[model samples]
Target: MRIISGKYAKRNLFTLKSNATRPTSDKVKESLFNSLGQFFSGGKVLDLYAGSGALGIEAVSRGYDQAFLVDVSGQACKIIKKNVDLTKEPERFKVIKTSDFRALKQFAEEGEIFDLVFLDPPYAKEKIIKVMNTLLENNLLAPHALVIAETDEHTDLPEVEGFELKKDHHLGRTKVKVYERT
Candidate 1:
């Protein structure tokens, strides 16, 4: 996979030979950033279920102030770190080698709030609702924060609390939903 825009645009990211993660496609990533527009210029970002840190790294490249990438896999974490270093945006991002549950709690305790959050968990897992609740409960989302969720077209996400759906789109087998924290 590769970064499609920003300072690191067209940069190749290290990929792991595992079925544990799915990197967001360039088309989807471009659409996501396009939808975000200036909100990412200097906004704080969180990439939940981060795979190769492609989304978060792209945010940094696009000028986001900072981004936190959280993942449960050691291999993914290693690749994320490498990608950050390679992009030379290490100062703009951090890698959290922990499960979403633990990272959510720690981020909250540390008073880390984000303006944009990317939720792209594994498809067919049905974990988006639980993760959204945790994000709200931990106050990780800043007021009016924009939360983008990418899932398989078949995945049905529950109407989560503390946020209102602003937009929903379907691109072939991919579903993109944008939510604004109320």
Candidate 2:
């Protein structure tokens, strides 16, 4: 896959060779960023289930200050590093090879907060809600932070207390939603 816009526009990214992870398609990525106003002035973003590091990398390329790309798979972490290296600005990204929950805990321990978070997990519905709550509980989200989730059509996102559903888009079998902190 390739970056669709910003500083790294048109740059190709490498994905893992396993079926356990799915990379967001360029169409959806483009449309999602378009909905978020594409380029940003500065902010920190987290790719909670980062597979190929594409989404987080794209965010940084689009002007976010930094991106934390987290993946549970060792292979995916290596691929993430390769993709980050391709950007030639290694400082812009921090790749974590760990489970989603563990990454969140680490962030909490560090008192880190995010302006945006991506929750495209293996199973979306339950995990997404849990992560949202964890983000809220730990104060890991910046004021009015946005949480974006990409999931299968069958996974329906619930109305979490601290977040307001912003946009929901369905593309073929994929369902994407954006939520903002209330």
The local lDDT score (0 to 100) that residue 99 gets in candidate 2 is 89
Model 2: lDDT to the true structure: 0.93
Which parts of model 1 are misplaced by more than 4 Å?
123-125
Off by over 4 Å in 2: none
- In the range 1-182, model 1's lDDT, one tens digit per residue, is 78888788899999778888877888888887887772355879899888999988888888888999999999999999999988875878889999887888899889999988889887533677787888888888888998888989888776777889988878778889999999
- For candidate 2, the per-residue lDDT at 91 reads 96
Residue-level error in angstroms, candidate 2, position 118: 0.3
Q: List the residue pairs that clash in candidate 2.
A: none
Q: Write the per-residue lDDT of candidate 2 for residues 1-182, one digit (tens) a residue.
A: 99889898898999988789888999989899999998999989999999999999999999999999999899999999999999999999999999898999999999999999999998789999999999999999999999998999888888999999999999878899999999
If scored against the real structure, what TM-score would every candidate get?
0.93, 0.98
